[model samples]
Target: MTAAKRQFHADVFITLKRLVNDPEGIEIRNGLHNLGYDDVSEVRAGKYMQLQVEAANEDEALASVNEMCERLLCNTVIEEFRVSILEPQAT
Candidate 1:
């Protein structure tokens, strides 16, 4: 008998650093305030991506996704990234 390869799903969020200026976020916040949503305090714009990865285990999958984020998905100089692994639901 052979072991089957495990598949993992990841959700990645890429956002600008706190010190970095986000014009789009500011614009959206202003628009919301103008629309009478005065309670809206801060708005931050970011990128969300879902990836299906094939790996032997959760650690391997996470490592691969981290590398992808560092190399291509996010700008490390001015952006920060977060990864969330989604557990497979029972069928």
Candidate 2:
């Protein structure tokens, strides 16, 4: 008998490279400064995604999430991504 696939939760974080200028982040910082929060020097905005994956094992789930990030989740040229895989949950 074959083992059943397990469920994995993946968290993806996408952000722009330091060399890249973030217009939105700058606007946010400007707004903060206007509100009397001048201590805020810089702000960098990013994206966070939570995904539930079905796989036979943790490694498989990780690979799948990585591929998803490389393919569609993130812009590899100007942006970078990080993935965190949680332990399998009870069925």
Candidate 3:
């Protein structure tokens, strides 16, 4: 066998559709109202995750993330996702 190589890092954000019901977001909006800030209209909730993956290059890393979004982390029917890749900063 051969050794593995590492390439890119990614950050993913998964959020519910604007029309979807989010209990957590509702609770937060209610709390904000109770706290005397009542100008908010609607609130949508979301989640964020960071991943460090090993791939040949940026394209491969993106492909991995795309598969992950479709198969596991995101519900494409009811939710949307945003993926951001972080290049190596420096030495």
Candidate 4:
């Protein structure tokens, strides 16, 4: 008999590498400065994604999500990604 798959929630964060230029981030920072929030010196824009997956365990879920990130969610050349697996939600 096969063990039932469990639902997993993944939070994926995608960001450009530090060496890459972030025009959107710079624009945001400039806007903030114009608004008198000069304390905001730097702003690095990024993407946040939530994914729901089915897997046997946390490890499997993490592996799948990592693969997803490496394959499609992020650009390895100029971007990096981080994955966080939250506790499985109740059915």
Candidate 5:
């Protein structure tokens, strides 16, 4: 991205392959139980990524990030994501 004017931030999530057993989740729940937090039953882990973008406006920034996600970052099949918009940073 060019260091000119607009900026965009993305908070992304990539879920684990469902076929793999969720041992981490089990461990978290077990640990919580040992800590007396018995109400907590399940905890699953996922991936998170943050990105900053440079563009003319929110529309361009979004399109750029969306393209990035589709082409590079996200799997688009197994992984699902949520995106966030941040104020543009001027250079």
Candidate 6:
């Protein structure tokens, strides 16, 4: 019998580069300080995305996820991304 293709889940985190100015993050930080959280120093806004892909192996799944991120998920010029493979949990 042929082996069934495996399904992979990818967790993508897209964050703005340090050199890029983040107005949203600054606003949040200011709010926090006003709320009495003076210890808070910096805040960075980002996006989190989950993707499901069908592939033969982990490598293939990762490659597909990376392509998706580069093409649609993240702006490579001003943003950076990280990918994590989530293992299936037991029932």
What is the lDDT of every predicted structure here? 0.91, 0.94, 0.85, 0.96, 0.73, 0.89
**Candidate 6 structure, TM-score to reference:** 0.89
Q: What pairs collide in candidate 6? A: none
Please, what is the TM-score per model? 0.90, 0.91, 0.82, 0.96, 0.68, 0.89
Q: Which ten residues in a row have the lowest lDDT in candidate 1?
A: 82-91
For residues 1-91, could you state the per-residue lDDT of candidate 1 as single tens digits? 6555577889999999999999999999999999999999999999999998877777878889999999999999999999987764434
Regions of candidate 5 where Cα sits further than 4 Å from its true position: 1-4, 16-21, 89-91
Superposition TM-score, candidate 4 onto the true structure: 0.96
lDDT of 2 at 74: 95
User: In model 2, which residue pairs have backbone atoms overlapping below 3 Å?
Assistant: none
Backbone Cα, N, C clashes tallied per candidate: 0, 0, 0, 0, 0, 0
Tell me which of candidates 2 and 5 scores higher on TM-score.
2
Residue-level lDDT of model 5, residues 1-91, one tens digit each, is: 6655666776666665676567777898899999999998677777788887777788777777777778888777666556666776545
User: For residues 1-91, could you state the per-residue lDDT of candidate 2 as single tens digits?
Assistant: 8778988999999999989999999999999999999999999999999999998888889899999999999999999999999998766
Report the lDDT tens digits of candidate 3 across residue range 1-91.
7545565789999999878889999999999899988899877789999998877667778889978998999999989998887774434
Question: Against the true structure, candidate 5 has what lDDT?
Answer: 0.73
Residue 63, candidate 6: how far off, in angstroms?
0.5
| Model 1, runs deviating above 4 Å | 1-3, 89-91
Query: lDDT of model 1 at residue 29?
Result: 99
| Best first by TM-score, ranked | 4, 2, 1, 6, 3, 5
**Candidate 4 at 11: error in angstroms?**
0.1
Better of 2 and 3 by lDDT: 2
Kindly indicate the candidate among 4 and 6 with the higher lDDT: 4
Which structure among the candidates has the greatest lDDT?
Answer: 4
Please, what are the lDDT tens digits per residue for candidate 4 over residues 1-91?
8879999999999999999999999999999999999999899999999999999999999999999999999999999999999989887
True-structure Cα RMSD, model 5: 3.8
Once fitted onto the true fold, the runs of candidate 4 whose alpha carbons sit more than 4 angstroms away are none
